[model samples]
Target: MPNLDDKNAIAFEFARICSLAAVKIMEIYKTDFESRGKDDKSPVTDADELAEEIILAELEKCLPGVPVLAEESFAAGFRPKTDGAFILVDPVDGTKEFINKNGEFTVNIALIENREPTAGCVFAPARERIFVGGDDAWAGTLKAGETVSPDALDPITTRARPSGGMTAVMSRSHADEKTLAFADAQGVVEKVSAGSSLKFCLVAEGSADVYPRFGPTKEWDTGAGHAVLNAAGGCVRMPDGAPFLYAKEEVEYLNGGFVAWGRID
Candidate 1:
């Protein structure tokens, strides 16, 4: 179990790693590349594999033996046991958005200990925005050709649920009737569509009140964003009102429905 100081340090490193992966993703995003389907029929591209390779290499150098469960790697049968502390990497979240050139994809990384994401970072290269949360939370922007650094970030936090009604952010690619119904039940005053983990970041920054994810998502898909939300005074929970957890070997890393709330009350 890492202490607060250790977790913060690791969180900073995770942000840097996500930034590097984001840069690689943006490079490929600007190219004329094609996507192919994975075994699960999810779209994957060279950017996903290339960015994951960069992130994995850096993780091995920075924290050797700390198990990493990355999207592309796991899809290729690299199932390393995550007994203690481990890293989760989604090299290019929102691949469909990326393929469509919607500029909603992101590079995600998280540090999980005891089945909880203690620290994480989400970087949207196309948008030049980075959101990090752990012992602290921050939102930052990157200029073209700029590198990521701690000094570039500004602290951010969640706001209380509005007195009127809450704003909700939903997935642009995966929105379905069930998700819309869930949002409607929450009394959402306004709805916004975004791709990738940015939905969680929006709630963390107080720009939105809640994000109900009724669609199927994997641990890597939400771990980093979950950490960010938690650090920013938010939480992600099961639809049945249980705390969301990670490293569920019994489920083969698949996550069920969840609600990420900016205000838990």
Candidate 2:
């Protein structure tokens, strides 16, 4: 139930925070970035903490009443208020790629209502592109170089079917054995890897045919991408073919398995 007129303000504000976080990340990327480990053994960095700090602070100011579930702050015992809905934030996705200075990392933010994503935004700071969408609109993609009118915003679309030669997308830095097996099972003829939610965007824009993620991913990691893909005539489905839902009561907020596709023809 987010108003589109107001959504831009919120999205713009989040974008600013993300941009700031991206700058901090870039600063770290330029130098010998520090590293540490979470209990799950996933990597963490100064960039992640700094960006999360900035994003969390801004969310506090901008959306004071709404509860926030962020990746960096989740381990600190912050359980979401499942009574209704909330916002999910991955202040920095693709931390490994960020560390590699590949510029494919992104800031992902999504507004979940009643366990469904109503609006979301993704910013590729280094690439200077931003993607934003809501249920009422076909998500819009903006790059640093183009002039786009509001009316000229293009609607995203998924491929009608898996291309003649399936082009499967995997994580650039986080590819796992299960993903490799899934791609092989699907008989993928081409494989492309990208960092962050760009995997979803690739399928949305028809650049790739499918994204099968068998590895672990938190709700925040896919909420924004889910909205984008759904708007683009694609879907994120559980392994058993159910639609993905967020704000589940589970404490971990971890997703099981999902296959993103334009369609399964």
Candidate 3:
């Protein structure tokens, strides 16, 4: 087995898997498909399940014995045992946007070690964007049928917090007064409405200063994006300024409110 600690390699493998899975997702995206709600009333589609199967199979080969915590599988009651080291995946992160044909959804995969997300890949297939991170971070544009190439990517890092009023990216569907109030209190001058884990990518690529989520989320929802943000010199923290860790099986991997931020200075 490859060194599990070699985060960059892991991220690259995830990027490849995301690229391959994206082909399947786009194939489904162009057709008229049906969607239904899971037990939680959240949307699910053929895209989600198929993309998940692709990602899960790839992860098994790349990581070998390490378990995975994937959104669709867990929702289907397939909980795998893990010991602080596992993979996290969200196949279709913006189902509403996807169902609406807005092209904001993503395919996400991450590697977690000791409860910290150490590497990840987030591919917005419809948008032709891909981001991956580990000890380093990269962003690039990719088209259908194209796999990730290191030469095609550019290194990315969060910019220092703007000297002026900050720009905050908030959830397009889940935005509530709490998030707006947080933005207001943070002296935000402008806000960008985004869907899916792309909000976290905005911070990682220095396009936005911060992303605040007040709603409950699953570890798979944030893990990949968190890894990208972290590798780009940013971080995710609890509202109380505590480290945001993962692998919360006790609470079914539900993540509490937290803030993802770029350089403070």
- The best candidate in terms of lDDT: 3
Each model's C-alpha lDDT?
A: 0.88, 0.75, 0.91
Once fitted onto the true fold, the runs of candidate 2 whose alpha carbons sit more than 4 angstroms away are 1-13, 136-155, 184-187
Model 1 over residues 118-147: C-alpha lDDT tens digits? 999888888988888878888889643456
Quote the positional error of residue 166 for candidate 1 in Å: 0.4
lDDT of 2 by residue, 65-140 (tens): 7888898888767776856767889977888777778889888888777787766767777787666656433335
Which of 1 and 2 is ahead in TM-score?
A: 1
Q: 2 or 3: which has the higher lDDT?
A: 3
User: What's the residue-level lDDT of 178 in candidate 1?
Assistant: 85
Each model's TM-score, in the order given? 0.95, 0.85, 0.98
Lowest summed lDDT over 10 consecutive residues: which window, candidate 1?
1-10
In model 2, what is the error at residue 229, expressed in angstroms?
1.4
Tens-digit lDDT track of model 3 for 89-122: 9999989999998999999999988899999999
Give per-residue lDDT, candidate 3, residue 195.
Answer: 91
Instruction: List runs of model 1 lying over 4 Å from the truth.
Output: 1-5, 143-145
| Prediction 1 TM-score vs. true | 0.95
Candidate 3, residue 38: Cα displacement in angstroms equals 0.9
